[model samples]
Target chain A: MAVVVQFAIGLVFGLGLVIAGMSNPAKVLNFLDIGAIRSGGWDPSLAFVLAGAIAVTFIGFRLVLRAAQPVFGESFHLPGKTGIDARIVIGPAIFGVGWGLAGFCPGPAFTALATGGGAALMFVVAMMAGMGAARWLANRRA
Target chain B: MRRSLCALAGAAGPDSVNTEFTPFASFLGGALIGAAAVMLMATMGRIAGVSGIAVRLLPPYAGGDVAGRLAFILGLVAAPVVVMMVTGSAPDLHIEAGPALLVVAGLLVGFGAVWGNGCTSGHGVCGLSRLSPRSLVATGVFMATAIATVYLTRHLM
Candidate 1:
């Protein structure tokens, strides 16, 4: 049941990417070109995808939170935070640059694999390794 | 209700910044994702931080946290379907590589999500906004590797 939901979610997210036209590498690559945004000639179509994703999720969260225990468990578990720092700004700027260039982030890339392809596969693998290395280091240091 | 409201608003023309996540849309798509992440955390006590949930799937996360994780994941997957059903027309899509490369990319990303403590979505959107030191480092690594990978593949020998 849980896995099914996960798959469903991934599928929808991918579908959203498809609908928003985010599945295209060229579009994403174009987004990365800050000069485009600066030139005021930027194609803001990707923004629509972002808006749709955010809107749908925002609405969904409202319902999900109303539940004491999401159909799967008890109470919400959020990461702790006190104030904004370098991580907040620097992290996004980095992400924006990559996202702007590659045109595909991790989620849609892997999900695209379900339908089948190479670029998605490459992205998924490298993304995993990055995550693994981060975890190992965090644990070791802890 | 909300959908209709959005429709009414979107009808405002091209200046709105659709953020539709499609090459055909605008920065509004990114903004939407960002806003969604913020609203999600504020409402659900969870950061729409996907990388974090994916990480919890490993050995160390064998506890009950999986349920919420499952739900968050589910919502993401469901959104697209709902969109297609409602919109009638689906957006365009294309991948640059073949199957073999896509698989390798998937695994590498999975590894990074764990090591980075969160993927860009989790850290970049949620963690970074909240000022998490860990998210900062993870985001840095995400970019460095991506640039290096793209550079090596797209240019240098």
Candidate 2:
């Protein structure tokens, strides 16, 4: 039952990504291209997407977290590390460089895998390889 | 009056600026995504962070609901198919990166997202929603860098 629910949620999330135009590299690049504001070609649709998602989530988390426990889980498994750290900043900074280059973040990249043609396939594969390498390095350190 | 107002808004003509601004669609989609995150939290007590979820599915697997995570990803892959059935076509997606760039970008995205412990969905949406300071910092840094990168690549390069 929980799996079913997760599958449904994933479907909704992916559809949202598609409808929001995050799956389109051109649209994403336009948003990232802040200089386009001068040329009158800047697209601010991505900001709206973030605003809308965050608004709903903020309200939703407030209400949902109040419950004793989730409907299906034994306990809520939130992130453990709380303090700001170099890893948090440096890691996302690296991710940002990649995102700007291709406009393919993790969610949209995966969501685009099926229909985004061969380029999408190449990106996903390379992404998986990168993920594997990161995991290996982390394990070695720990 | 409307013409002047439009000019003030920098929208004097459809071609002038923001020709692709679909505020309504974007907002609706975002709401749906938020709803999905809420549902995941409500039902399973999991954060709907795509990078976190995807990384767990890789080798040296983390302990948790592996099957559930797989189902979620499979559903994501199937979403376009559903859209095609309902709307008679898949959503449009254009890849500006060639194979080499795609690979490089993919590596950075995969590694960075995992190392950082989140991505846009995780940090930008879920983390901000929870009002985590770490998330706020992470989001700010990434957004700034991403903007800078675009400017450098598209403008300076």
Candidates, DockQ? 0.22, 0.57
**Which predicted model would earn the best DockQ?**
2
Winner by lDDT: 2
Mind giving the per-residue lDDT tens digits that candidate 2 earns over B78-131?
A: 888798899998898777676888899999989988888899999999999998
lDDT of 1 by residue, B31-146 (tens): 44655564444444566656666656555664445665656555654554455577864344455433444445455555545543456567655555555676666666665555
Error of 2 at A35 (Å): 0.8
lDDT of 2 at B137: 86
Query: Could you give the CAPRI-style class of model 1?
Result: incorrect
- Please give the interface root mean square deviation for model 1, in Å: 7.0
lDDT minimum window of 10 residues, candidate 2 chain B: B10-19
- Give interface RMSD, per candidate: 7.0, 2.7
What are the per-residue Cα lDDT tens digits for candidate 2 across A1-142? Answer: 8788888989999999889988787788789888888777788989989988998999998899999999998888788889988889988998898898888898899889889889899999988888788778878888
Clashes of 1: 85
